[model samples]
Target chain A: QKEVEQDPGPLSVPEGAIVSLNCTYSNSAFQYFMWYRQYSRKGPELLMYTYSSGNKEDGRFTAQVDKSSKYISLFIRDSQPSDSATYLCAMSAGDSGGGADGLTFGKGTHLIIQP
Target chain B: DAGITQSPRYKITETGRQVTLMCHQTWSHSYMFWYRQDLGHGLRLIYYSAAADITDKGEVPDGYVVSRSKTENFPLTLESATRSQTSVYFCASSGAGQGLISPLHFGNGTRLTVT
Candidate 1:
């Protein structure tokens, strides 16, 4: 099984609606969860970050991590057309020193917010 | 100033050809990474470097290589390109901190098409 799993969603929603995107992982060792936004022909940009099992809120976005179930989620309030983009969920295990091992990512979910 | 810049924003090459994608960052970050995004496959790490001259393989490393000769640059080379290697390549950098906890800054991706 892939380390991380996310639905490839082209979810369409109306503007001002609430949007939720989620991911699940098979590795319990993953401790850091992150959400990234990518527009067409652009690079993925960091959107939300969380450590372990907890919830973090930034602006209109909220990231929640549940370590027990290895599930992570990102919620966007008052979604806008500008929020139409692919949402990627990424995670990493705790780093041991400066090694280049840790970051693992899931297949992103495409989202669209229409007027 | 450009945080991170990728050269040859778009590239097309034939099979068995050698192509190198260049990534440079102005932040002097201690960590740099190479990831490829394929349709319906999200983003997968190909390689990463914690510091100059230190590198490691990631999830998918076959047919590709990376070198970090300087803190500000990380380049990915396709030794012999294959059709499967056609994907959007992204380079990211992070400050001196633990992975799984640090937020990465990404550059505009390089769209590579191997015919």
Candidate 2:
């Protein structure tokens, strides 16, 4: 089984709808969970970061991590067309000392916010 | 802020040719990372450096070489590029990359096509 698993979705939602993206991991060692947004032909940008198991809120985005189930989720409130992008989930096994290995990423979920 | 920048936003090269992607960060972060993003594979770490002259390989490090002659620059070179080497490359840096709470900043990415 892959270390991280995320649905590669082209999920379409109407404007102002709430969107939720999730990822599952097989490794329980991951201590930091992150969500990134990538526009077409662009690099991934850090959106939300959560440590261990908890909920973090930033602007209209909220990230939740449940270490017990090895599941993490990102929820978007009042989504807009500008929010259309690929969302990638990543986690590390306690940073692995200066970013050497430890990070495993999901395939990313493609989201489309219709106007 | 021009935090991190990558050279040659796009490139097209022939297979077997040597290609180098340059990464520069204005933050002077102690740790820098190189990652490749494919259509379905998400992001895979290729190499990383904790400081100048200190570099290490990551998951998909084969056929790739990295050098960190200076803290602000980490370049990745493909000695003999293969068709499979074609992907979008990203450079990232963090203040406390060895820990669990540092926020990572990413470059705009470089798209390389090996023909």
Candidate 3:
């Protein structure tokens, strides 16, 4: 199985709808979880970041991580057409000395917010 | 101008030709990474560097070479480009303060096509 699994979804939603994107990871050592948003033909940009388990909120976006279940999620509240993009989930198992392997990324979920 | 930037936003080259993608960051981050994004593969790491002169291979590094002669520049070179190597390349950098778990800032991306 892949280290990280995410549905490559072209999920479409109406404006102001709530959107939930999820990912499952097989690696238990991943302590740092992040969500990135990528527009067409552009690189991924960091959206939300969380350490270990728990939830982190930033404006209309909220990120949650569950270490026990090896699951992570990003929720978008009141979505807009401008929010349409690809969302990628990334994580890493960091060492104490700082330097460690690069993050493993899941297949991004493509989202479309309809106006 | 303050963030990471990648050169030759679009490239078209013949197979077997050598191609180099340039990455420059203004932050002088301690960690630099090279990743390629494909339709089915999403994003896969090719190479990474923790500091100048230190480089390591990542998951998909077979056809790629990398050098980090300076902290702000990490270039990815494909000695003999293959059709399979045609994909969008992204350069990212993260600071050392948060170690390997630091959130990455990505460049706009370089789309390369190997004919």
Candidate 4:
């Protein structure tokens, strides 16, 4: 099985709706969790990140990580058309010598916010 | 600008040809990485470098070569390109001494099509 699993969803929702995207991982060593937003033809940008098992909130976005279940989630509040993009969950487990090993990414979820 | 940038935003090459994708980062980050994104496969690490002159392979490194001669540049070369090597490539960097959880900054990405 893949290390990380995420539904490649084209989930469509109306504006101002709440959207929840999730990912499940098989690795137990992952300590750093991140969410990235990728627009069409553009590289992904970091949206939110959390360490270990906890919740981190940033404005309309909230990132939650449950290490025991190997699950991570990103919730979007007051979604807008501008929020239509692919969301990818990435995780890493490395020492303090920097994260040169890079990260393991999920298949990504394609979210569409209708106007 | 003070961010990572990738060259040859779009490239088209024939099978068995050699092509090089360039990545430059102005942040002088201690860690640099190369990843390829494709449909169904999500994003997979190709290679990564920790500081200059230190490089290592990631999940998919076959048929590819990388060198980090300078701190700001990490180039990926296809020894002999195959149709399977065509994908969107991204370059990313993260700072060292950030305590194992530094966020990654990614370039705009390079799209290569092998025919």
Q: Provide the lDDT at B34 for model 4.
A: 95
Poorest stretch of ten by lDDT in candidate 4 chain B: B95-104
Q: Residues B15-99, candidate 4, lDDT per residue (tens digit)?
A: 9999999999999898999999999999999999988999999999999999999999999999899999989999999886556
lDDT of 4 by residue, A1-115 (tens): 9999999989999999999999999989888898999999999999987778999999999999999999999999999999999999999876532255788899999999999
lDDT of 1 by residue, B1-115 (tens): 9599999999999999999999999987888989898877778889989899999888899999899889999999999999999999999888746433357778899999999
Q: Residue A89 in model 2: shift from native, Å?
A: 0.8
Share of real interface contacts recovered by each model? 0.42, 0.41, 0.47, 0.67
Deviating ranges (above 4 Å) for candidate 4: A96-98, B98-100
lDDT of 2 by residue, B11-104 (tens): 9999999999999999878888998989888889898887899888888999999998889999999999999999999999977754444666
Q: Kindly list the per-residue Cα lDDT of model 2 for residues A1-115, writing each as its tens digit.
A: 8899999999999999999999999988788888989999777887987888989999999999999999999999999999999999989876542244436789999999999
Please report the candidate that would top TM-score against the real structure: 4
Among the numbered candidates, top lDDT falls to: 4
What lDDT does each candidate get?
A: 0.87, 0.88, 0.90, 0.92
TM-score of chain B of each: 0.95, 0.95, 0.95, 0.96
| lDDT for B112 (candidate 1) | 96
lDDT of 1 by residue, A1-115 (tens): 8889999988999999999999999988777788989898888888887778999999999999999988999999999999999999988776632224536778999999999
**Higher DockQ: candidate 1 or 2?**
1
What TM-score does prediction 4 earn? 0.97
Off by over 4 Å in 3: A96-100, B97-101
Task: Specify the poorest-scoring 10-residue window by lDDT in model 2 chain A.
Answer: A94-103
TM-score of each: 0.94, 0.94, 0.95, 0.97
